[model samples]
Target: MRFLVITLIVHRPDPVTGITPSARDRLREVVDSAVLAEELGFDGFGVGERHERPFISSSPPVVLSHLAARTSRIRLFTAVTTLSLLDPVRAYEDYATLDNLSDGRLELIIGKGNGTAQRELFNVTPEDQWDRNAESYELFRQIWRQDTITAQPRYRPALHEAEVWPRPYQQPIRVWHGSATSRESVDLAARYGDPLFSANVTNPIEPYAELVHYYRQRWAEYGHDPALAAVGAGTAGFHVAPRSQDAVAAYAPVFAGQLAFQRSMGMEPVFPTLEDFIERSSALIGSPQQIIDKVHRYHEQFGHSVLHLHAEAGGLPPAEHRASLELFQSEVAPALRRTIPDPPWPWAPVLPEAAVTAAAD
Candidate 1:
């Protein structure tokens, strides 16, 4: 399986000390984390986009572009680009440039983002969100594939034989549809034969599993090859120590802090306690063996080939956070890599040509 480390760049206070980093410090941490992910041999590193409070990830393209300059080999991803609130033309322009800058290492996970705050900022109603997501994606696909495109979309201004500059370094960049409690996203992914990425963080496995099942059913119904159906899943949290008991002890406070934050936001958590969250949700808080077992269990249900773990510890100390990631790399990843097979993607970007060209330039 392909493994990824993702961060939402949430700017929250340290749970133990109640100290929050400055915006610049937070962004620097994100960059440092991406660098660490590559050094530790992660397949990809993702940055989330959230145009709201307590999040410094409102501009993923800019952040990812900076990462592109500092790292090589590790693919850069937008965890879920909020397509519903964006103009496809502008989004295409920025990502196309990023694709070139990253030497075709850009992969997008698109979704109609949640939360009423962003929707209000974009002047999008709840009723039109799905439609906006679908429409924007269709147009975005056209912009990447065709050189000259003439089109009219209900949500965005018309494109009349317009040419978007900086053609993607990869002919057709890979796009994974992000699904979170929505069949519309699943249907859209199935209809286009694109991959589906389940946001398996908020709820239990049942809901996300049902959606994956639905996606597969639709993929078959749409006459796409079953072998080509690619699915990715996300974990709520992660912390692996030498012993399971030690991991539990270390992460308990982090979990309590997270719950407190959720409660403050008036959001009821599905997993009430830390133990419950570890048992029921995708939080991999235990020894490496336990994490592997949990992944195998979920893989049986979702048939996912790609898995993403949180890069940031909710409120753990930097030393503990780094140690967890180190443990994952040294212990957990090797086992999982051997056990699980990677999905068959149509193509991967050829970096040699782009690298040579940039050097010459």
Candidate 2:
């Protein structure tokens, strides 16, 4: 199974000390975490995009470009690129350039992002978000696959035999539709035979599992090979200690702070307490064996080949966070990797000859 370390780049005070780092320090930490992820054998590192308060990830391409310069092998991902709010032409150009700069080690997970603040900033109505996402993706896909394209899209300016320059390093880098609560995203992914990444953070496993099952059903309905329908899942949180009880104790304050923050935003959490969150949600807080067992249990429902855990601690100290990651790398990951098989994917970039022939005449 492929493992990814992802962060939303939230800028919140430390739960214990109530101290927040400077913007520069926070960004530096993100870069350092990506380097560490590569050193620790993670397959991918993802940076999220959000244009709201408490989030410093509004510019994913710039952040990922920095990561590309620092790391050689680990794949860089946009946890969810908020494509609905972006112009496909500009988005294509930026990511295409990033693809080249990263030597084709770029993958995208696109979504119609949540929250009213960002939607308002982008002037996107809730009614039109899904349609915008679909149209944007179709145009972006065309831009990647063809040299010249003519598109009369509803949400963006028309394209007239346009050639978006800086051809991608990967002939069509893989895209995974980020699915949260909606079937529209799932249907879109299935229609294009693209992969799906479940935002398995907010709610219980049943809803997310149902969404995955729905995605598989639609994949077959769309006549794509079942073998090729890949899926990935994200955990709410992660921390591992020498003993299960120690992990629970260590993460309690972090979870409490997170819950309080969520409630302050007028959002009611399903998992109200740390124990409830660990037991019910996808949060992986326990000993190595406990984490392994929980992953296996979720895998039974998700059939997911990729799993992403938070790279940065929400409120835990840096030392404890690093220790948890080290324990995961040394103890939990090896066992899971042995038990789970990777989903079928074309990892290598398409041949130049193939891309040339595939391009528009």
Candidate 3:
């Protein structure tokens, strides 16, 4: 299976330490984590976009552009670019430039953003956010695929033979639709024949597993090849210890913080205890073997070949964070890769699709 390290760039007091890193330092940590993810041989490193408090990842293109310069091989990802709140033209310009800067190693996971603060900030209502997301992406996809675009979109001004510059490095960049308990995103992804990325973090396995099933069903219903449908799943939390008991114990405080934060949002806790969380909730907390088994189990249900782990250290000590990730690469990743192979990508593995087509001609 392919692996990615992704962060929402949650900027808050350390749950364990009660100390918050300065904004500058927090941003620097994101850079360092991307560098480390590349060094550890992870397939991709993603930074999320959240226009709200307690998150500093509002500008994924800028952060990913810096990562492009810092690393050479790992693909850069936008966990979810929040198309609902963005101007697609501006987004296309930024990401197209980023694709060039990154030498065409870019993939996107686009979604209608959540949170009341973001919705109000962008003046997008719940009733229309999904419509906005679908419309924006339809325009964004055309901008990437065509040199000159002339179209009328509801959410944005009409374009007549418009030529957006920095023409993409990729012929048409690969996009993954990110959805959490939303059939709208799933339907859109299936309709466009794009991959689906399940936000498997917030809930139990049943919901995400069912959504993957629905995505596949919809893919077939849309007359797309079932074999071509791809899925990626996210982890709720992650830690690997030499022993199961130690792993649970080591990760207890992190879970406590998570529980408290969930409550502070005035939401009910799904998994009330750490043990239940590990047993359910898609969090990989246990010995290496246990984690490997859990991932394989999820694979059976999700049929997901790509998986993401939290890149942020969160409440864990710096050393513990580094060690746990190192251990995962050393022990857990190899096993999963052998058992679950990745689906083939539509574009050329190395060269951009444009380059490949040019060579063929």
Candidate 4:
């Protein structure tokens, strides 16, 4: 299985102790954690975008470009580029430039973002977001693949033939549809023969598993190879210690803070308690064995080759976060990798020039 590190860049006041990181510190920590993810053998590192209070990753492309310069091998991704809220031409030009800089190692996951904050910020209606997402993606895809294209849409003017330049390193960088409780995203992925990444963070597995099944069924119906239908799954949280109790004790405060923040925002708490949260939700907080078991169970439901884990959220202390990541890489990752083969990503395997030179050194 391919392991990916996903970040929300959330910083919430401590529900129990009332402590939170400064905005500057939170941004620095995100970059530090992304660098560490590479050192720890994660295949990909992605940052989520949010245009609201408590979230600092509103500009993922800038952050990812910085990460690209700092790290050599790991693939970089935007967890979900809010395509609906963006101008398609600009988004294509910027990310295609990033793809060239990253040497064919960029994956774009597009979505209609959750929450009303972004919609209000961009003056988009929730009902119209899907239409915007579809139109923007169609144009973006053409911009990547075709040298010249003529297109007209509600938001864009007619183009006789416009060529978007600094074309991507890859002929067309892969796109994964980010689905959060939407059949529209699933159908879009199926229609385009792109992959689907389910947001299983805030909910249980049944709902998402059904979506994956729907995607596969539709993919086959669309005359694509069912085996080529790639699906990626997301988890809520992760904290693996030497013992289960220690893991819970270490992560509970942060989890509690997150739950409280969610409730304060008038969003329903997905779990009743921390214990219940880890058990039912995709929060993988436990010992190595327990984590391994839970991931395997999710694999059965998701049947996905890539499993993304959110180990750092709500601004957990940096040191504690590093320790949790270390334990996962040292103890949990090897066992999981041994049990499952890596996912098929055509752009995943090229070695960076630095690695080649280092071997000579």
Model 3: runs farther than 4 Å from truth? 346-350, 353-361
| Candidate closer to the true structure by lDDT (higher is better), 1 or 2 | 2
**lDDT of candidate 2 over 122-204, digit per residue (tens):** 99999999999999999999999999999899988788989999988887689999999989999999999999999999999
**Candidate 1 local lDDT, residue 313:** 65
Window of ten residues with lowest summed lDDT in model 4:
347-356
Native-vs-model 4 lDDT? 0.84
Ten-residue region with minimum lDDT total, candidate 2: 346-355
- For candidate 3, the per-residue lDDT at 273 reads 94
Model 4 residue 353 distance off true place after TM-score fit, in angstroms: 18
Give the clash count for model 4.
0
lDDT of each: 0.92, 0.92, 0.91, 0.84
Q: What local lDDT does model 4 show for residue 71?
A: 92
Q: Candidate 2, which segments miss by more than 4 Å at Cα?
A: 346-361
User: What is the TM-score (0 to 1) of candidate 3?
Assistant: 0.96
lDDT of 1 by residue, 298-317 (tens): 99999999999988766888
Better of 2 and 4 by lDDT: 2
TM-score of each: 0.96, 0.96, 0.96, 0.92
| Most lDDT-accurate candidate | 2
142: Cα error in model 1, Å: 0.4
Query: Which lDDT tens digits does candidate 4 get at residues 112-202?
Result: 8987887899988987889999999999999888889899888778777988787667765789999989799999999999999999988
Once model 1 is optimally superposed onto the true structure by TM-score, how far is the C-alpha of residue 17 displaced, in angstroms? 1.8
Candidate 2 has an lDDT of 0.92
